[model samples]
Target: MKAYAVLVPGLAASAPADADVRAFTETYEYSTQPEGTTSVQLWHTARRVTWDEDYAEEFEHRIEIKHGVSEHWDVATSTVLVQSGRNGLTLDRVVLGPRYRFADRAEWPVDVTLALEAGKVADRSIYPLELRVVAARDIDSLTLAANGIVGVQVGADVIDEVDLAIGWAAGASYQLHNKLRIGAETWGGTADEGPRPPTDGVNASVGPVVHVAPSSKLWVTGTAGFGLTDNADVVAV
Candidate 1:
């Protein structure tokens, strides 16, 4: 039996809403589940302030569903079905994509994955593609893992906002046990909206993550992150 873990941390920022007003601003990471398995995730995020001089608190509730297409392939979808505070409680966009893992070949020390995502953002549609590399080395009683991601945003909405937008996410983790692991992850990106790459400045967060496997059919994860830069949310717990 095999299991899939959501070890990748999400990129936090603002997402465009209806009327091209940039109404709601925020974000995350999408990882695939294990083969022959179905997973449902409930994730939440909270913010008190931002870099735009807006002093408002925001909270978001996201629901994600993942199904393994094969041993090395997965299809997943996530939706911000509920939200509150600054963004208000409303249905947000839904993103669906497939992720493929290059685990059969051992030529490279790092495991690689390519993913493509597209869906609705408010009333607009978007297509974002990413490539992820996972590097891991196991030591006595502990396992260390490193991950890096790079991608671009494409769609009618994105074209209206910038010529080309790129984003990246990187993080590392330590496995304390087969069912529990702890780590710190930082993710940020840039687009054509500003001077160049990392245009709006980089937003970073440090935090602890926990994963529990209560049974072969279920796995649970919880994470809390504190903002490390002015561009990030004050606290996401």
Candidate 2:
């Protein structure tokens, strides 16, 4: 059978509830997410902490590896399978958090997201019909959209407040004078209002995505940001 999908990496993938969604596209597509891009990310997060921040530097040499699939990463109909691992050094064990992703452009033609909100363990790795609306234009030099997320975990124990959260993000992508493109995104949200509260903090980050190829099967992108939440958001790699 012809390969409808290629194996890209949802490698930059976060947690279903806490992972940052903006940086996910490049990891999933393993290239550039163009107009007709469709992909999936396999991600996870793990962590251990101590009340005494003094021991924060105690952890060392943590490693992990995971795998999943993607659509439209290398090709539109191509299903890209992905596997990734991670390592870290902190006061405790593997860092934990949820994952997040904005829907593919073709689905909304503007901006949209489907996400879950939990930090420790994932409620479900598959898309669960959780979506956020986006408002933008069709084909413009710059694409801007505003979206938010709200979700709960059913299979696990519920404390009502632990699952409910408020989060929103604004993202934009622009094409420069040449093939070089510029893109940026900002996102933040709050989680854990439960009794045994996982972690009550705000999660926010902003970064730029560079598209060297602009329009090509192969491309490169890198990102950096800070996340403040008690969620388990693990990138496959």
Candidate 3:
């Protein structure tokens, strides 16, 4: 489940027409909120995992607030809560992300954005840092987007060395109406183990996405993801 609330109604009103249409739930788009506008988003996800004879369900909730600093830059902060199996929900992490776009849409073949994120996990000494390159293009009413991501852990606990992880997400969506859109998305990631070829294991999923913007201040996006590898959850929503 997801929701979007714009705080500065006047600024949002003057934004571009497509600014409020989010094509993919898991894919990052190239557009940022209008300058001086703030938007709040809430997200919830649940996944089913099975291993041998054991099965478990995991749930996560996140709330994020994003503010546009300029036409090219936006910053966001989020808090995560998670529950696994029979355990009660607990605070998982806090994250801060800042994104910047290179130029106006259609100025180049594809719009490009750079995103940097940092997070502190609960009870973990290490802090995680992630960098992503987001690229997107609009072809008439259809939109295509992709993201390349790299992440590493830092802090006193990782003073010796750090391993890198690589991931990617891509999606394509077409607007069906002023308030509805549909898309498909796929994402996968691999972690590097010490001295090993980065192929230790992989987690991947692919699924269909639906986005509904009932109004300028409220929007919902949902996806039903199926695992593509042994390491991924059996099903996710």
Q: Alpha carbon lDDT of residue 34, candidate 1?
A: 49
Positional deviation of 57 in candidate 1, in angstroms?
2.2
Model 2 per-residue lDDT tens digits across residues 99-164: 223454556555433322222222333222233433444366665666665544333345442445
- Which model is ahead, 1 or 3, in terms of lDDT? 3
For residues 153-174, could you state the per-residue lDDT of candidate 3 as single tens digits? 8776765478578898899998
Clashing pairs in 1: 10-29, 13-26, 14-25, 14-26, 15-25, 15-26
TM-scores, one per candidate: 0.68, 0.44, 0.89
Cα RMSD of predicted structure 3:
3.4
- True-structure RMSD, every candidate: 10.3, 11.0, 3.4
- By TM-score, who's the top model here? 3
Residue 5 miss distance in model 1 (angstroms): 9.2
Each model's total of backbone clashes: 6, 45, 0
Candidates by TM-score, descending order: 3, 1, 2
> What lDDT score is found at residue 34 in candidate 2?
32
lDDT of 1: 0.51
Would you give me the overall lDDT of model 3?
0.80
lDDT of each: 0.51, 0.36, 0.80
Off by over 4 Å in 3: 1-21, 51-53, 156-160, 192-199
